[model samples]
Structures are given as C-alpha cells and as structure tokens.
Target: MKTAPARPEAAPAPAPPVRRARARRLLMCRPTTFEVSYAINPWMDPAVPVDAALATAQWERLYRLYLALGHQVELIEALPGLPDMVYAANGATVVDGKVLGARFRNAERAAEGAAYLDWFRAHGFTEIHDPLHINEGEGDLLTCDSFILAGWGFRTAPEAHREVEAVFGRPVIPLELVDPRFYHLDTALAVLDGDEIMYHPEAFEPRSRALLRRLFPDALLADRADAEAFGLNAMSDGLNVVLPRAAEGLARQLAERGFNPIGVDLSELLKGGGNVKCCTLELRAPALGQ
Candidate 1:
C-alpha cells in the first residue's frame, strides 16, 4: 500500500476587528400617570397631577413627536407600581454590537435595568453584558464617532467609567457632574446635526465646560431659559428635532439651520424631571460608526 501524503497545515483565520453598532432606531416608554419616586419622595408637589388621563395624553403627544421625526417607535406597557420605569432611557447602552444593561445608581430606578435586559433578550440580541461597577445605562454615555464621554457623580461612578472604556476599547472622558438636579449627562448636553452640541453651562464644571467648547467651537450656546424649557437637550434626527412646544424661539433657530422642529408637550413628564431625550432611549444611531 502507498503511504498517504501528509495533510497540509490549515492557515489560521484572522480575527475580526471590533465594530461599534450604530443607533438608527430607538425605543421609548411613555410616562404613565403614576407618582414618580422623585415627585413623591422628599415632599410631594400638589400642582403636579399624577392622574392616568393627563399622563396618557402627554405620552400620546410625545409618541406623535417621535413618529413625526421618522423613528420606529416601540412602546412598552406601563409597569404597575414602578413610576420611574417610565424613564426607560436610563436602562441600557448599545455598543460594539452588544447591549450593556445598566446597574442603576438610584435604588428606585434599579428595576429598570432588569426590564432592559428582558427587552434585549426578547429582541434577539444575544450579546448582552453588564458592568460589575455601578452605572446607569445610556444616561451616563455620550458617544460620538471617535469617543464616549461618561458622566460620573450622581448617576454613574468613576469605576463604571473605566469599565466602559475597557469594553469599548476607545477613549472615555470622565466628567464630574456637579449638579444633582441634572442627574445624567443627557440632561445637560446633547449632540445635534453638524457636530454642534446644546448644553447648559451651569450644570458643568468650568474645566469641563471649556473642554466642551473646544471640542465644538461652532456649537451654539442655547439660552438658559430655553435650556430650562427642554429646548437645549432636544432629540434630533438630522432633519428634525423633537422639542417642547413652548420652545418657539429655539425652534426658529433650528429652522434657520435647516432643521424642522416638531414640538411635543411633555409638561407632566418634565414636572417629574425630564423631556424628550430623557424619555426616549436611542438603541443605535448612524454617527456612532465611523
């Protein structure tokens, strides 16, 4: 019998370069007419109504606004007994084709993380992970094409910031959120069309403010009054912005810049402490991938 020729060794396969997932669509949970922990705790505000009818109406308006902006909205059923669950945006972060479930800093908001994980699994997203360190989802993350700016202090810790950097393999700038009122990074800042950022100066440290200005020299400084009215941190889809109905002046500014502003009345939601950007969680966006 002829001896068998030796098999040629197999070439090693090259490892695939990691790619960050881009958020093109999003998920938003409308606030129900329930008492949010913040609104009830410490001291209740009698003026803020938590009746089901009013909350439902406000959420419907918010839904219409998101739909008008060309977003594929996924509405979640109200979680009975969990008021903060309405702020679903604070639940998770999508990066590098993986969903990182949050570990909320606020005890009242902790249940939101588990809800996010459940949603991820149901949507067929198998690459889900969570940081061992305390962090509160996309609220702490502000991602651009090159870097992710994470806020630490109230919602996310310094240790969580470092862990996020390791997971993304990119630069993570740690920002100290000095103001407790504006708990998350998104509450104080947002990136709009053309790399322009809308931010509130009073919410950031002087050094952090300077760094932001340097990053986007052309960034328009939104007025304090407008910022307070939810004009500064509005969500944009390159063509339009979902803003507060009362922000007509800011809308005019955006219109001049070629953006169509669609206003939504989130009065009740705002009273509970947030607006459109705070209510909606962007799962992926185009700018995230360079």
Candidate 2:
C-alpha cells in the first residue's frame, strides 16, 4: 500500500488586535496638600488669583465631588513644594496596560514630565513611553475603547501624535485646533456617552468641525456661553462628571439624564489654566485575563 500523503500544515492564525481595557481606577492629585498656580494667562486677564483661603475651599469642594462619584481617589504626595507643577492630569493617559507620559509642548510646563514619571513608576506602571521631539498629553487626546483622537496645534504637536500611534498600535485620528484661546482639546471638545460629543465650534477649523460631525453625528453642540462657563470640555468618567460649580443648570440636566454630576468650584484652579480634568491622571485598567 502506498504511504499516506503528508497532511498540509495549517497556517498560523493572525494575531488579534490589542484592545484597551476599561479604566476602573484613576489617579487624582490632592490640591489641599499641593501648591499650584493659576496665573496662566495675562493677555486675557480672565482668571482670578487663587489665594490660600480660596484654594482651600476649592480643594474641599473638589474632594467632595470625587468622593460622591465613588472613585477611589489616590492622592499622590505633593511634589516637593513645586507650586506650578500641580497640574497633574495634563501629563498622561493610561490604556492597554501601558502609560503614555505627556511631552508638554509648553516650555513653562516641561517639568511636568519628570513629575509624572515619578508617579508612574511609584504606581508600578512599567510600560511607559513618550515622543522624543514633540510634546503631547491627555489634553490633546480623547481615547475610547476603539480609537484615540489626537488634537494637534497649540498644545499637542504632530510628532507626538505619531509617537502615540506607534506605541498603541492603533490609529490616531488627527484634529487641528484653530483657536488658540481654547489652548487644548479638553478645553473645546468632550466625548460623552455613546457617539455623542460636546463641542464648541468656534474652537475648531471648518475642516476639523466637519470631521468631528462625521465622527460623532449625534454630538450635542452646547452654547459657547455654557461651554465656556462650565469648562464643558473638561474630564468625565462616563458615569459621573466633575465640573465648575457655576454650571448648576448643566449639572441638573445631567443628573436628570442618569449621570451623576460632581460639581467642583475650580475658579482658583481655572485661574491657573486648568479644571477638574486637568489636575489628575487615570492609570490603565487591569488588562483582560489578569
């Protein structure tokens, strides 16, 4: 009998694309114990100086807001009396078992990277990387389960976006910010639940606006007055939101819609050029199969 023919070997299956795990634990800096500045803009002269009394009160309010939202807030030790280094949330984004520390384009804030690196290592985040030539941070990025939208212009550089794409092994949708007044993406755009987004049209170019509309067709265009008043593009947890106390009406509306709004009075912090989302960093969620 003839020997049986050798069976054809099956080709190895292609590797599955990596999926970012859902964020569960977040890192937020405590303003009560930290020295921060709010003299971010003089041209606009729009922000109020944060005295000790005002800063204390605002910290209390922000702390309460975070607690009410049910997040396990880890207050990192204040950075060695660095008054201007307290804006921690603008430093990084954690996803898919990796930490992408920010490369701040602003020379005034370049020290932010070192501060964040210490925090990341202290928290046991080993997989970390950043762009060599450009500065980028969470302020320029909006990450979902599927993709990351990177805003490039005043705050985040084009080279930084490319670095993010390379590290995450995913596409980084580039958006050009037209208005310098907005400063960062978080100042003018926010991705709410589902495909709904909240934005200020004036902050973006016509091309960027068109792209945003296409990406989030159901986006809610908030009045510029409301957006500006409340820091509408600030950070959110999907289930809850932290906003300026002045946004009482918006908070109520969100509450009625099944979202828990934790309103914090960040007038002092905003004076320094940031709000709730600007002062904390969310670490990566535990990877699947962990």
Candidate 3:
C-alpha cells in the first residue's frame, strides 16, 4: 500500500494592526476659578457646592498627563470672572493652522471669545475668521479626516455650519442634537482616530443618528450609563484614550478595541459641566510644506 501523504502545515495567524498615538499640540486652562454659579446646561447646578481645590488638582493631573504623553501643552491665562473659560476647547477651532474664533451664545461667555482670538492673533496665527454666526468652537465643531462634523439645535446655530465650511474649505456634515443634557457635541461624541468615533446615539435626533450611522459605520456605541458619566467627553491620540474613571463600561469597550484607556478623576470639574475633552483643545497645525 502507498504511504499516506504528509499532513499540511497550519498557517500562523496574522498580527493585529498597530495603532499609533500622534503627538498633539493641545491647549488647556488651569481651573483656579472653577465654580457652578449658573445653570447653562443640565449638568450644572449652582445649588451644589463645587470643590475648587479638587477641580484644580484634577485639571493639573490632566495637564501633566498630556505632557507625559509627549503632547505639547499650551496655556491661555484664565480670566478671573470667567469660570467656564477653563473649558478651553470652546475658545477656538484650529485646523490646518487656520483659526476659527468662537462666538458664544450666552453673554456670560461673550468676553472669552475676544480673549481667545487675541491669544491666537498675538501668537502669529494669521488665517483667522471671527465668525458672524454664534458658535462654540470645538465644543460644537469636530474635525474628521475629510470633513468637519458639526452639531446644532443646542448651542451652535445651524447657520454657523455653513460659515465653518466656507472658512475651512472642507465639507461640513450637520448633526442635530436633541437632548438637553448632551448639549455640546463634544459631550455626546468623541473622535478616536482618523474618521473613527465613539458616540451616544440617543443624544442626537433620529435623522442625525441615521446620518452618523451612515457616515461612521464602525463607530463605537456608548450606553446611557457611560454617556451620563461623561465617557464620550474624552480625548484620544489614536492609540490612547483619556476618559472619566467613572466610565467603566466605555473603558472596557475601548480596551476590547485595542485602545489604551487612561482613567482620570474629573468629578470635581464635572460640577462645572466639563471634563477631559472640554478642558483640552487640540491645535491641529498643518504639517510643514503643506
């Protein structure tokens, strides 16, 4: 009888794609004057006492963490009267080295717009647009790879979307937010990597939800628990994600997706209706020779 053929060898499994962390240039403010004196959003309740010291300590941790992660941290001096100025992401939206200065919807934050724009002007940013429409900077406008995803029906006016598209020369996809609790787009959604995002669907209108699904088919979905914990209010450098420690469920989901999730305690800052992404603003300067 003929000898049996040798068995075929098994092929080794392919290695997982390595995720990289981009070195970001971020802007942040010290929460030295943090307090919830007024109720602008549902999260803010002046009746509840705010721990200013704890908020400062927590903010410092986040600031130091950015430095430790090889990201450039820039500070815009915090104005005494403007308690919410600590949410630096609302100052401006920087893309390709161009600045779109914010126009606050509330009179309480009106002066902050001028302060931030002055900083950019003083720092040598020329291509700046002082928007005519009411917009909240990165709080309502988020940049993706080829387009800018904007949220309206809350803080940012729908007209602001058109102005941003013209200023950036990029396509703007408008998403309508319905929930009062998730007023700002940054509060309800966080961009993970290039064109990758994680969001709380219930925070948006039905049409906006459908649009999000169509745009980002593989986006991470966060439950109401995680959303309420300010989980979606996160900052990511592609591979590493910094979010609230209270968002245990989102952390697990991020870890399962091969992302390094860094948990931080910003509960004190939360009293003022802000967190990681709120405190940190990304400065997306163009690459040399662009």
Candidate 4:
C-alpha cells in the first residue's frame, strides 16, 4: 500500500561523458643550459638568439605550476651540452612503468637520448625497451585511451610502431605526418579526452587526416594559426591545461569545455622547437592487477 503511490518513475540519470583519466604524475627536466645553438626542426632557427636565463625562469614557472596543481614532477638532472634536454618528452616514453628508450635520429641529440634512458634505468623502470629502431619517444608515441597513437614520416620510424605494440601489448595506430612544421605528433594533435581530439589537419596527410576524422568522429578541427603557436602541444591534467601563451584559440576552446587553461611563456624554449607538452612527459603507472 505504501508502494501503491508508485513514485512517479524517477528520471533516468544522464550518462557520464567518456573521458580519459587526466595525467597527474609527470616527468620534467630543468632548462639549466637550454639554448638554440643548432636548428633541428623548422621552428628552430639558429640565427634567432635564445636567452638561457629566460628559458630557465620560464621552465621554473611551469614546474612550480605543475607542483602547485598537486602533480608528481619527476626529474632527470640537467647535464651540460644537452641544450635541448629541457624538452623531456623527446627523451623517452613511459607506459605503465615500461620505458621505451629513444633512438634519436640526429647525432646532435643522440647523447641526450642515452642520458634519458640511463635515468630511467636508474629510477626503477625495469622493463626498458632499448629501441631497435629510431623513435623520438613521446614526441611521436602517445597513449590514447584504449590504444596508442604512433606518428611517422618524420622523427619516429614506422618499424618502431610495431615494436611499441609488441612491448605495450596494445593496439598501435600509425598516423603519418605530411608537413614538416608538425614534425612531431605532439605538435599537431592533443588528446582532449578519451574520445575527443584536437588537431590541425594541414600537418597530416590526407589519409591520416581522414583516418583521424573516422576514428574520432567528434574531433576538434584546428587551423594553421593554432599550429603556428603550438596550440596542440598542451598538457592536460583533467580539469586544467597548460599551454603556450600565444594559443588563445585553444585556451578559449578549452575554457568553453570547463577546463582551466594556464598559459605560460615558453618562447625561449620554442627556439629549439617545443612548447608546454614538449617540456612535460606523462609517466603512466601500472594499472591495477599488474
């Protein structure tokens, strides 16, 4: 009888939007000796002077910001002669504590790669995969929600993708980059969440661009302007995103989605062809039951 009033059917609860868990633990290197002594990518111009003190100060601000956000910031000691070492994302990629060492393509950065691998080994990444093929670490390899996205036709070799799949025990989707500007995958695309991606199509080949659309049907399309400012090279911690000061469009877009965008001036490091994501590496830990 108490149930006789059969409470009006409760409204069905709205389904939660699918999202990739935000990264909290990250790896970063101090720009103790960063400078643009040589040009590796298009964005790097040796003629353009870089202020080492300014770069160090900017990087300090970023590191402090990550800490202020309650993120675990790991470090690899800053060594002399490794001017580009500040772009820690390029050193190596960590997937569930499994380290995939970088086999850098250029000799100038070769030592930097080895230094990173050494640090990983000394720091408890036991399952280190010394690369058999040249791969530029997280700059080209990114762990999207259920799978890994590999970028080639630039720094990382296609062969490396297969090795990554075998090592990580996950499906690896290879996307080819066509433009030199977006030399690294991190420079062209940012995984906003599990199902949402932000990218600039001009950086990718038509096939890869089409594949991105098919894979992420609701991807956010970005323009060359955004790419120029390295908008896609942003680091997200679920609720907040750290991006370049010049990426106003990306900041607004993220703000509309309820994300707090923290912009920083990484222009000094940009002389070596990198930005926010470039300085940060998300080191994922092992999943439960591992």
Question: Which model scores highest in TM-score?
Answer: 3
Answer with 3 or 4, whichever has the higher TM-score: 3
Clashing pairs in 3: none
Q: lDDT (0-100) at residue 9 of candidate 1?
A: 95
What would the TM-scores of all predictions be? 0.82, 0.81, 0.94, 0.91
Candidate 3 lDDT, 66-111, residue by residue in tens: 9999999999999889999999999999999999999999888899
Of the candidates numbered 1 and 3, which has the greater TM-score value? 3
Give per-candidate clash totals: 5, 5, 0, 0
Q: How well is each residue in 1-290 modelled by candidate 4, as lDDT tens digits?
A: 35565668889865545333354888899988787788879988888878888888989999999989889999988789888889999998888778888988888898988899898888877898888999999999878787788999989999999899988898998999999989999999987666567888889889998888899887777778878999899888767778888988878877766667789988888888999999998888988889
lDDT of 2 at 49: 41
Ranking of candidates on lDDT, top first: 3, 4, 1, 2
Instruction: Encode model 1's per-residue lDDT on 1-290: one tens digit a residue.
Output: 99999999999865432322222477777666356555422223646556667776887777776665456888665576667666666778776666778897767667778877888889877778866988877777877656787887777889987788877676887777787766788777776653556677777888888887788676656676776676754777666677888877878876666666778887777766767776777776322644
Per-candidate Cα lDDT values, in order, are: 0.71, 0.66, 0.92, 0.86
Runs of candidate 3 exceeding 4 Å displacement: 1-16
TM-score between candidate 1 and the true structure: 0.82
lDDT of 1 at 235: 77
Q: On a 0 to 100 scale, what is the lDDT of residue 226 in model 2?
A: 56
